[model samples]
Target: MKQRGIWPDEFTFAPLLKACANLEDLEMGQGVHKHVLALGFGRFGSIRIGIVELYSGCGRMMEAKKVFDEMPHRDVILWNLMVKGYSQSGNVDMGLGLFRQMGERTVVSWNLMISLLAQNGREKEALALFHEMRNGEFEPDEATVVTVLPVCAQLGELDLGRWIHSYAKSKGLYPNLVSVGNALVDFFGKSGDLETAITIFNDMPRKNVVSWNAAISNCAFNGKGELGVQLFDEMLDEGVRPNDSTYVGAFACCAHAGLVQRGGDLFDSMIANHDIEPTIEHYGCMVDLLGRGGCLKEAHKLVETMTMEPNAAIWGALVSACRTHGEMELAEYALKELIKLESWNSGNYVLLSNIYADRGKWEDVEKVRVLMSGNSIKKAPGQSTIV
Candidate 1:
């Protein structure tokens, strides 16, 4: 078109800009921005929205802000995009600020803000916002219900989750939407109410991979490893394709139950039949399983054979195994690898020192203490927050 002495319109630029954003080609995005400016298209709302999205996608928040500030009129969609960009980039406060600045908000705006806060571990603030939203006469939608339910589950706020469930039921929103039902399943699963999770799952008119993964993984996480294993079998029997997460959940179950041979078999089957390449988490689970069974050498070899470099968790598992089995030399080796990887967690130092102390190696214990003190490393105190 340029060769023909013709210019592309906003419709032409929007898709091109979106392509640039998807590719993260900052230079191309800038070129598009320049073209938009040269064509005097900045005043067009649709073009401006695309520009904002392009800049935000390229991580040029300042540029996006410039576009936002110059917009003579804005809509909820524009506000939603800006808030989403901030939240996605870990600037939750900025996202909330943008939301508060808006004179009006849609359900999308409210859900985005609430979900962002809840997903990012600001459960207390999320709950407060939910309550405030209700007080202001904003009825919670399916998205809002789904978003905050997991927060309640994670914080073990079963009562809050139950209240949300009740509200969702009263609003005639339960068991219909897969998303809402899935969230409820996850919430109950995380709260150690496997029976309730199962009931919800069974009652769901539809089930997705997320619903199954959540229920199974929660069982493993909550120390019902045997039951989790059983569920894994049932999931397979039902022909629900297990993904990498499912394998991890099953491996975790085997690890917790000290089912070494079974764990190894399942690990092999994951590669053979499931065709899901084992990730670092899966490798870590195997190490934990073998280590707990006094198969330190096997665990060490497994780490060595891993396709990717073993992370701190894998080494930590070996170190823990060594400590459990009184394999001081192996523990020392694992500790050295951990330290080499720059894993500065004070607990690692403490664990190694305790191992030495257990073996009556006073000199080694003293050395570890000296190193920890020299580095000013202190163990973090365990604290629990109700809200």
Candidate 2:
């Protein structure tokens, strides 16, 4: 309060800076930095850490690094913040470098590194880091198990996931916390072991929306759409409030099962009965459901009436449906919209070109080829794996 001749102290500025970071108010953060300097608190370690955290939280990695570099002495917490900042800002290389440079690291450091790698699609590297952590005498905690289990699910490394499961059980960590149980359910579901997922779901001491949504999504994704719909009803009957993700999963099941009327009913019920507004994803599922049942006109009408602009995925789905039904004209319309939304995505170009080639439209095919060449869009090689 400059008017009152009072200035905030380091303790006051610390939290104020944190608030600015959370709000992503870079200008206010800079003003607070000046206040810290004016109060002669610039050399304070806690305040410096607060500044680094502020910059990092605002996605200002360079500014965060500058604050970190100016610190004469750094502690474990500072190192953790820097590592987390780089990792979250998509500088995984810098994150890993800082992680390796630490002379001494706490379990939090290890967990952060593993989780960061896993989330960035480096499941293999995440697993290797977990093994390295074990060899370094750091005991795996509940947080570590929760972090690495998803990596196992993504890579379909069921064996590694099982090992983590066994470790969790022996450590008396399984089914106690919903987070760990949710991860186990997702892992089992992704690994094509629905039985185990169901068992874990049944045995959990307490079930949350995430637990139910994970099981429901697993069913929908694994080709058991009818089962997924059944579970959706069960979840609602048991008085669990369905979230957007739950609705998405249920809609996906309906689409896959060709339950057009049922999908429409659920879409209406989501807003009228449940008071949950349908999102773009829900609309996309409706389009797929109608298109799959040879109701392309209805799907097109739904798209035209969508509250939000249809994204590339929805248009891509419609294009795919048109191709399946041999409706070249409709496919061309959807393909044009998809290309406009994602010009760099070569898959859209390739799909449109193939549809034209299939229908003996040589001129259209040649046009697509020439466009691809001009854009330097090379088709990615197709790869398949048998599980």
Model 2 lDDT at residue 380: 68
Any runs in candidate 1 off by more than 4 Å, and if so which? 1-7, 170-172, 343-347, 357-387
| Overall lDDT per candidate, in order of appearance | 0.84, 0.88
The most accurate candidate by TM-score is 1
What's the TM-score of each model vs. the native?
Answer: 0.88, 0.88
Give candidate 2 regions above 4 Å deviation. Answer: 1-5, 339-387
Model 1, residue 336: displacement in angstroms? 2.4
lDDT tens string, model 2, 1-387? 779998777678888888897898999999999989888999878889889988887778898999899888889888998998899999999999999999889999999999999889888999999999999999999899889888888888889899989988888888777888999999999899998998998899999999999998989888888888998999989999999999899988887887888888889999998899878988988888888887888899999999999998899888878878978889888998998898898888887787777778888888888887888877767822111
| TM value for model 2 | 0.88
Query: Clashing residue pairs in candidate 1, if any?
Result: none
> Candidate 2: lDDT of 32?
92
lDDT of 2 at 344: 90
lDDT of 1 by residue, 225-334 (tens): 88888888888898989899888888888878777898999999999998889899999999999999999999999999999999988898898888889888999889
Q: CA RMSD for every model?
A: 4.4, 4.2
